[model samples]
Target: MTLVAFRYWLAGMSLALATLVTPLSTAQAISPLGGPRFAAVLMDADTNEILYAEQATAIRHPASITKVMTLYIVFDALDAGRLRLDDRVVMTPRAVSQRPSKLGIGVGQSLSVEEAISVVAVKSANDVAVALAEKVGGSEENFARLMTAKARQLGMRQTVFANASGLPDPAHFTSAQDIAILSAAMIRHHPDRYRCFSEQSYSYGRLRLANHNKLLGVVPGLDGIKTGFTNDSGFTLTASAIRGGRRLIAVVLGSPSGWQRDRDITTLLNTGFTALDIRRNGGIEDMPALLSSAGFTLNRSLRPVPQLATLDVEEGDGE
Candidate 1:
């Protein structure tokens, strides 16, 4: 079924099952890990409701999660007919000079846009990110400007992009809520291309680059998205999952470790799904109360959602 039709059908099913949903016990609720650097936000993809949030609006480094926005620009180019998957993306010296966690393609070598996207999405290839940036925006610096512009256009007021690969720059930062917005926009505007994020691995020549996102096959209904890390950002992840025919986007940033980041995201998604079910069934009045019952510490001062302007873990200097 078409996505829209499926969403409509899912809404109906949710409402029908609402009356049958039992009270949520403590056993059913998952509490996320807490940390000084931790920030997160969970959103219902269909309704854009903020289901759970903790330090969600605080500024934090994005790490390799920057690639999500990079990919978004590429997807936009594809939609505008300026880019094609089969088109060649040459590896420039600058792209090759990028840090590790790269595809290792030679400076002069080339790969199709499709392959480039896979390596960036699945492998978190820094080199390929720069190549794609240069391809689309002439240089990484210029591309970053475009990234920031797109962020503003999409109502992401707190984000700023300093590079295409999300390498550490004092200027490159975003909040968890902003990341959730970006994730939803990608799924909303480019469902087809977004599937690339779900790929577990990508074959480029003899190398089989595995996705850095460890939760892919392990978490039920969890699908495409991204993972990132750096000394400054800690371990971060933006995950999307569909349960009970509803999709939710969860973003966790600045965890102390990769495993913890994954764990927090899993808990957030689970808690979010349960809360959504309860809300649909008329068992809850407000999200704060539900989150409290689920054992989450809420930062009661949430910033108001702005009107629309439009729209991983790892080591080294890259991930």
Candidate 2:
């Protein structure tokens, strides 16, 4: 069968198998946060088919993962000739005053649009994020409105953007499914620009900043994406990988720690790829069995609940 035909068939089969699996109950749906604060989704990026989900639609804080949408808007501006890579983005006092995990660019100092993108993608620079927002939307407040509009346009019904850098706000929120949709949109709409997410480190003058997503090089087939954390959001990640031309997007939100978050997403992607292979070779019946098996379950008992003090300061730096 042709590749397109095969993908369509596979999507149908996966959806059918999804119907057979029982949804997790409120008690069983608990996140590593010791509550129902977590949500996860694994999707076949190429087909946009959901392979597995746990409270995927639950609302949760997005933290610095909000930068993905920030960059998306920047990319759109670049594409429309409204912005240029070489154009300078000046740091306003407001941008410079943003919290830690920032570029530390001073007021009146400036960086090129391209440099701003790299800083935001690799370092999760909150200051640069605000600069980019202001550059694109005149003000961060207006930029957030634009972000919400774009999210709606992208069909992210549960997502609402409140800031450019994803600082804590009771108003800001998104879901695992919505984040998966955003990740897929980034891959689908801005394949070239998406490379920024894979950058391990970025340098400016005397300072060198590293990317927070640690699994980029360690996990085979894994590539560019983003990570986030906050007192309200916990640890969140949206990752994408490709193997044998098949790509998958996995999102894990509100984990207790970065270690558990990374580990959970890794497991999700690995299981997702294995399930795809089983569906492709062994048949659709084998796929569901694999996902439902005891071996595929995430071990939540071992996760340690972090201190409230730590969560207050752990936004974009650690992962």
Candidate 3:
């Protein structure tokens, strides 16, 4: 689709979205040619320089991207010795009640804290997220408060947390800039456990759940961070890639579809790498050539939506 038409299409899909949230910060950079209206940021992880930013501080619904904070808090607990990789997380009835994009563990059943981390990181499992929150904060509500407090400490000034699982709460919001802050903080503070974000899949008994972040395989140096979506938040991703000793974190919020989000991220990463003069393992190319050759627009290389039947939990409202 032409860029103009694509913007209108995106706007049409999100009419109700406008009233649900507002951008506290405005983006100055024009959306790159053939891109949709969204908020984004690209940063040099080591230098903490802004490589490119568009509505980076704009308030937007985080959807499941809120799990990045959920994991951050979990990682902090791990660092403090308050939680352990082998600690058991007993599934609460409240946890069992979360919506899909979840691990279907039953109430009273338990998995190790490390296993819970892998489940949420790889699968974006809502149930597991709530369980971790309960373990850490005694309740999801309390954990969300801690998430907001920690966000403040990390300088994610615009972020707020309504729940641990990142379900659709109007009050639950974050900016691309805040997400980048969270991503960078995780990399700096807990490098050891950050690999959970790059895991492609997690197995529970007979079922297997795949990571929603599609760029992990398609992008040369891309490692991970997270992916999130709800009808409310559109599709959002915070991704990091390393090449020639430099790392870049790119955040894209409010894409119309999963493929578009991936395409935009790939484009942003390509642009950021170019700006840094960092070459990919196979050499480098311009944005259009990089994207077209990588097949973002043409290929419908979406992360496969896991079949709900694969999860064993009883479902209720969730993201």
Clash tally, candidates in order? 5, 0, 2
Score candidate 1 by TM-score against the native: 0.81
Return the TM-score for each candidate structure.
0.81, 0.84, 0.77
**Candidate 2 RMSD to the correct structure:** 9.7
Alpha carbon lDDT of residue 301, candidate 1? 22
Worst 10 residues of 3 by lDDT: 301-310
For 67-170, candidate 2 gives per-residue lDDT tens digits of 99999999998998989999999999999888878878689999999999999999898999999999988789777777776777787877767789988765
lDDT of 2 at 235: 78
Best-first order by lDDT: 2, 1, 3
On lDDT, the stronger of 1 and 3 is: 1
Candidate 1 per-residue lDDT, tens place, 47-91, comes to 888887787777777788899999999999898898999999999
Candidate with the larger TM-score of 1 and 3: 1
Q: How close is candidate 3 to the true structure, as a TM-score?
A: 0.77
Best by lDDT: 2
Per-residue lDDT tens digits for candidate 3, residues 1-319, read 9853553344333422433444433221112232224677878899888766767776777778888889998998888888898999999999988888778878999999989998889888898899999998877877777777677678876777879887776666777899998999998898989999888877877888888887888898898989877655567789999987889999887676777778888887877777567344455535445445555342221222221221232232232
